[model samples]
Target: MPILQPIGRTLLIFFAAAGRLSMFAANGLSHCVRPPLYFRLIARQMIDIGYYSLPVVGLTAIFTGMVLALQSYTGFARFAAESAIPNVVVISITRELGPVLAGLMVAGRVGAAMAAEIGTMRVTEQIDALDTLATNPFKYLVAPRLIAGITTLPILVFIADIIGVFGGYVVSIYKLGFNPTTYLKNTVDFVQTEDVVSGLVKAAVFGFLITLMGCYHGYNSKGGAQGVGAATTNAVVSASILILCCNYFITEMFFAR
Candidate 1:
């Protein structure tokens, strides 16, 4: 009975959260269409979320590619498929790993930050103050972050894909003793436009999911500092989970023919 109670409670919370999230999204869409158009806020979010996030995303991408190449090389060598290294590396990075890693990193970094910031605002009565001052909190706070996320994630993923491939290139050539010229040639020839497009699409969806989760949790935060902390944690966890789930569906849609 105790175990069943816990499981039931967990399911209840999940459904409640999902319902709130649906309403939150609908509110956001309505505000987005009827906005006073906060372009300045959107631009600021772009710089903060996109520009400031570049270094971490790039570093993660490079290291991921390098490590993947090393491991894939070791595995492929056993099957005597060494020449396929470039193809595998490029496809793996561009199709799934690059966008997924970028999204996870951004969720950990940007999502938590957004949730904390907004949660703080909520607890401090600052959001209430905004309401008193004739400002729509959704427009002022949510819209810019949502738009910035939609715009920037694809760019980050694109950069990640390139850097990850380059990392693989370096590892294959310098560390693993593969011919640089042939590696580059195979990578270029094997990587298709669809691979890149699929990654970009996934990135955009991930970006939106991350930002939405952050905004939703933070905007609805309760308690005080402890509540804010919980919201931040929830935002990161939810965003990361959603990114992984969405990535699979997107991949299936793109390539599961």
Candidate 2:
């Protein structure tokens, strides 16, 4: 009975947390559709989530693509299947690596920032002050971030796909001694619109999860500065984990035969 108690308690806590998150998400998304929309705040969040994140996302994508190309060449060469390198690189990047890498990078950067900022506001009573001021904090803070995340991540992933594919092209042509024209043709011929679209969809979902986890953790934070730090860490870790988990489910939905 004692051992069963611990398992039961853990399950209870998990379900409670899940319920709270679902409610938080529903409230935030409901506010997103309501009136008094803050375009300015949304725009600011867009720049923060998208433009400011470009350098890290781009660099990660390029390096991932390059390493993937090199690794694929090494593996495929052993089987005299080196000609398939471009196809693999293009398909892998457009379908998985670009979105996943970009989402993880942004989760580390933007998710932590959102949690820290909001958790500070929570600890300092700023969020309560907004309530006194007749301003809905969810609309003003969470909605903008959520909207920006959903709208911007697809664009980020799209640009990442291009840069990633280009990186593969450079590595395959220069380091792997592959002909540029053949590699380009193979890449173009192999990639389908569904692959790119599926990746963008995953990016949008990941963006939403990142911002939502950050906001939820921060908004519910306690214990002052220490809580803020914990929330920030939780935001990044939870968002990254969710991105990976959701990526698999989304991929299954899109491509599983």
Candidate 3:
């Protein structure tokens, strides 16, 4: 009976949390679609989430491309199949690595910031004050973030894709002594429109999930400062996990036979 009690408690808690998250997502999404959007706030968030994040995302993408090229070379060299490096690099970057890595990086940076800022507001009673002042917190805060996230992530991922592929190009030509013209040709020839589209779609989804998790945690925080801290941590962890899980499912949807 004691063991069963623990299992049942855990299951109940999981379901309760899931329900709350789904409701929050629905409410926030509704606000996003309805009128009275704060476009200035949305643009501000887009700059914060996308422009300020470029350095970290760019560095991560470039280094990832470099490493991927090196590793792909080492593996393909095993069978004298070195000619396949460009194809592998381009397809892999456009389809998987660029968006996933960019998502995770932004999730860590932007997600934590959102949780901390909003959680602080919650603990400080600013959200309630907004309600008292005839303002909708969801419309003012959550919607702007959700809109910015969904719109900006695709652009960020697109830039990351270019930088990553260029990184691979640099390595293949400079370090691996491959002909630049041939490498670019193979990359262009092998990659398809669907691959890029799939990645952008994944980026948009990831952006939404990241902002949603951050806002949900922040909006529901309690216990004062410690609560805000916990919310920030949860926001980043949840966003990152969702990014990886969604990455798998999206890749399967796009590429699986």
Looking at model 2, residue 57 earns an lDDT score of 96
Ranking by lDDT: 3, 2, 1
Model 2: residue 222 alpha-carbon error in angstroms: 0.9
Residue pairs clashing in model 1 are none
Q: Considering lDDT, which of the candidate structures 1 and 3 is the better prediction for this target? A: 3
The TM-scores, one per candidate, come to 0.94, 0.98, 0.98
Q: lDDT score, residue 253, model 3?
A: 93
Off by over 4 Å in 3: none
Task: For model 2, name the residue pairs that clash.
Answer: none
lDDT of 1 by residue, 163-198 (tens): 999999999999999998999999999999999999
Query: What alpha-carbon RMSD in Å does predicted model 3 have with respect to the real structure?
Result: 0.8
Clashing pairs in 3: none
TM-score of 1: 0.94
lDDT of candidate 2 over 137-238, digit per residue (tens): 999989999999999999999999999999999999899898999999999998999999999999999999999999999999999999999999999999
